[model samples]
Target: MPSTVFDIPTWVNPKVAPDRHVQIAKALYSVPGDLIGQRLSARVDAQTVKLYFRGELIKVHPRIAAGRRQTDPADLPSELTAYAMRDLNTLQRRAESHGTHIGIYTAAVLEHPLPWTKMRQVYRLLGLVRRHGADIVDDACRRSLDAEVVDVGVIDRMLARGATGQQLTLLPPPAPSRFVRSATDFAVRRPS
Candidate 1:
């Protein structure tokens, strides 16, 4: 697949002098996980190297602009030039470490949705149960099982009882019928 070029935004300022080694280090660190099976987009200009990991902006090395103000292709820094080759080497190592020899394009095809989305929602509800159902388990036992176990049945039963109680409390009170308007009518009222 053809490589795509990303235009680096002019306003972004780099805090440190960009060294190729440091830039590579920042890039590796900025990535969320072990870079074994991921795709990276690296752009090197006169002043900086910006990396995008899995389509997300990850790191920027500002040292690329240390001596140059103009973005002349001919005046690209030697460090950046060396970094381009070095970055490729690192990418190769990452690929091999992950047991794959494919380039970034091929890796993109293999990426899957993050698992945390499902895990987080389940974790939140489980947390609620743990906080509210403290009486159900001993403190020592709760601590041991907190990270490993989920009590689905207890949560369901608690929720069911709460719903039933609410339904009963919300019921309308009984009202007297118009036909039986007064107690005197039922009592012996003189014929009128």
Candidate 2:
């Protein structure tokens, strides 16, 4: 009998997870952000893993050990690269570039026991800056920080309702009417 080559790569069809990664041999490999929730074919061999989408090669990564992750920052959304890499400073700097208060506000928003969990909120805040302008977002962030609120949704609501903070000045109380007695008038007078 003659010796013959019999090496073949194992093929796997995996669905890209919400995090834009696929598992091969227990190791996680990142895919493009647009591929999330889509099925992809992977060719796994001894040295590398190749991913294909719709029969077209999309990504290739060196095979890693089990319980490890191989992520390419370019494979993730630009806004999410910092989060995926747990680079909190990047987000803070991005926010600060818009405004000092915006940076402080984002830091407050991301100040959690598990800060990565709040990355999406920071992402939303930055998006708000783009949509509503940096000055507007910075104003909202300043107001929110003054109010001790750290919610992106609240800032978004402020922008949606055109809360420029200038129009929120307190108005003087209306003059008392004879018909409406003051609360003190209803109180029983105790004998001295």
lDDT by candidate, in order shown: 0.40, 0.90
Can you give the TM-score per candidate against the true fold?
A: 0.21, 0.59
Question: Could you give candidate 2's per-residue lDDT for residues 1-192 as a string of tens digits?
Answer: 659666589999999999889988999999975977899999998889999999999999999999999999999998778777989899889999999999999889878899888888988998998888999899988999999988899999889878554455689998999999899989999899
Off by over 4 Å in 1: 1-117, 133-192
Q: By TM-score, how accurate is candidate 1?
A: 0.21
After TM-score superposition, what is the CA distance of residue 120 in candidate 1 from its true location, in Å?
Answer: 3.3
lDDT: worst 10-residue window of model 2: 161-170
Tell me how candidate 2 scores on lDDT.
Answer: 0.90
Name the candidate that leads on lDDT. 2
Clashing pairs in 2: none
User: Which whole-number lDDT from 0 to 100 does residue 69 have in model 1?
Assistant: 31
